[model samples]
Target: MASRSFKELSFVSIFFSTLATSYLFFPTVFANTHVISIISPLTLVVLDIQGDGFTAMEYVYSTVLFFATSIILFYVGITNFREERLFSEKPLTSRLADFVSAGVSRDHPHLSLFLLAGFTIPFVFMAQMLTLVLFFNIPMPLSLVLLTVSAAFIEEFAKSIGLYAVARERPGFLTPRNLLLAAVAIGSGFLVGEKLLLFATLAQITESIFGSVLFLSLQVLWMPLLLHITGVLITGGFLLLWGRQGYGPGLIAACTVHSLYNLHFLMGALL
Candidate 1:
């Protein structure tokens, strides 16, 4: 009875949290309503305003709330899965440890590349929200430093997600040859998605100083492509060599390399 009650509570929590999170992404779903009620983490009523827009503080708070609720939803869902035996019998942390250490997987390189390409859209959206929140609330050189580190971590972690997914489903794909192939595919996918996004929605920023730095624009087309490919290779190489224990150190190494690259561009822009 207790377990059933907990499951029901978890389901309700997830459903509402998911609904609130979706609102963050697409508020237009509620555009027809005049009374706007803002809920954070699905339960707390943060604000009730009769306007379409938000104050700067409200916006920041809402973004933070979104992050909180997203985390809650993920945790609740994972716990529910564990309770339902959908996941292995191991504890959640143990399962996660094994998952990361399980190594990489294999698939058709073309298909893998194509599927992974779309991941950049979500990654960019996440990074944009994070960037806006930081730049809005923080000041000066500190903000710049945080932005550089945050951006690098987000992008590198985004690529790692795709690699981890592949590893989870496809065993024996962690060979040196396969790692190189996967790295190439992931990098190519990210390049394609990023360019498409820029061409479609972010064209205006391409000429701005920050835009040039953010996108790593270069006259030589191959430069950005090579950079991304090399970045992923650094992470993938670590995973290939260290098995399950390599992901954290690998991510840190990749982020460090990426951060240096971004910092160089940003400093040049500032100068």
Candidate 2:
């Protein structure tokens, strides 16, 4: 028990140290003359009085911060679960299942969905950062494939985390009617959060073809909302039909559908 405690302590110390190191070194990556602007809607509007938009460094730093925060929160979540003595003689997968099942608030489905919506923002930002980093310099067709697949995987996984957390947390929650309502709630929450973030920090990107593809901005707002709803329903349906073991397959199914949706837009942009 002592050895396990020491190992956990060491791991935490290393994680924080790495985070601090990243913070210290981050400024060195960009020019000293670069003005640091907060990525809020008001800040952007105020700073762009001269018509000069956000700098690349601003976006980079914001993305890095979001990605870092997500990682830290994920670690904290696992630690909290461990502290609750949730881990037992069960296999790793079983422990993970238990963790997911217990992570959400009991009897508070609305609150869980709301929190999940907020939780997804950082993860989606992380996904955008990763997609850009991985496919920045790659050529057209290959980059398109990679970008679509990676984005789909990340976004679907993010949505799935919320779905499973709520669906598996209690009995009768995974029923068809309940899952349908949960899917709608989760999708609506995600859509609102996603659009707000885009309006605040990513409005500029919407002007470009790549941004259009990434954000899936269409003439009608309902399309994106519908897409999100459809994606959640696909996953939720799998869970409803297959029971607890359905999450993995459901996530994969959602990812596949999302990938196809993204690919269609990407192809249209290319042509």
Candidate 3:
């Protein structure tokens, strides 16, 4: 009976926490009935000054869409770990807590650490911005190639760095399942950060009329997100297979796969 009550309390706590986080991250979702896109300075630079806007409904939907996707991805990670019985014999709350704890003793990457990995997206974005600014004049084919390589290296390394650090702190974390879950958390974080940044960019630089349309369109798509998750999984898998040697090969392979995926889009954009 006490255990049942404890589990009920845990569920309630998680539910409320999720709601609070949602509001904190996207206060606009609950604030106004209507959302208007005004001409920001970035839009002025990147586009004509047009008064267009995304409705509050659209904004809310887009935000919810990404969060839902992130939740699903994170759940997949937990499910995978559970399939391996990583949390076997533990109470529900203990299992939940262990999954998010950063230490190896818990058998999973820390939840906070996963989120911090996601925040690294901005740093990767800045690097991308620098590459564009400095090398914009490069030939399209060459530039695409450079961008692909650069993006792959930077993103993979950024996403993997946290896992590597934690593993270093606790060598036992190098196990296959733990490594995989770590990658999942990092990838999920990357997706969240990337989507948030893209939305912000669209709001500021792209016209509201176009940005909202694009955001809505993307909400239905999962391929790009899946590719990112897969890339991280591969990187983590390599680390497990090759031990120390896996680091270089894993990074290179991740970058190559990631770049190839982007190259398809680049080719379409150019041609």
Candidate closest to the true structure, highest TM-score:
2
Ranking by lDDT: 2, 1, 3
TM-score of 3: 0.54
lDDT of 2 by residue, 1-271 (tens): 1113456658667876764454344332322222222322233444477476667655654554456466757754764555444435544444444555554666777566755665576658545644544464578668768777887787777777777765655657778777777777777777787766666666655564545566763445787677777888888888888866887888888889888887887677677
* Candidates 1 and 3, the one with greater TM-score: 1
- Indicate the TM-score of model 1: 0.62
* Cα shift from native, residue 115, model 1 (Å): 2.2
Candidate No. with top lDDT: 2
Arranged by TM-score, best first:
2, 1, 3
Candidate 2 vs 3: which has more lDDT:
2
Residue pairs in clash, model 3:
37-53
- On residues 131-165, what C-alpha lDDT tens digit does candidate 1 reach at each position? 53335335767766776777777778777766655
Q: Which residue pairs overlap in candidate 1's backbone?
A: 101-244
Model 3 whole-model lDDT (C-alpha atoms): 0.54
What lDDT does candidate 3 reach at residue 171? Answer: 61
Q: Which residue runs of candidate 2 sit more than 4 Å off their true CA positions?
A: 1-103, 206-209, 217-219
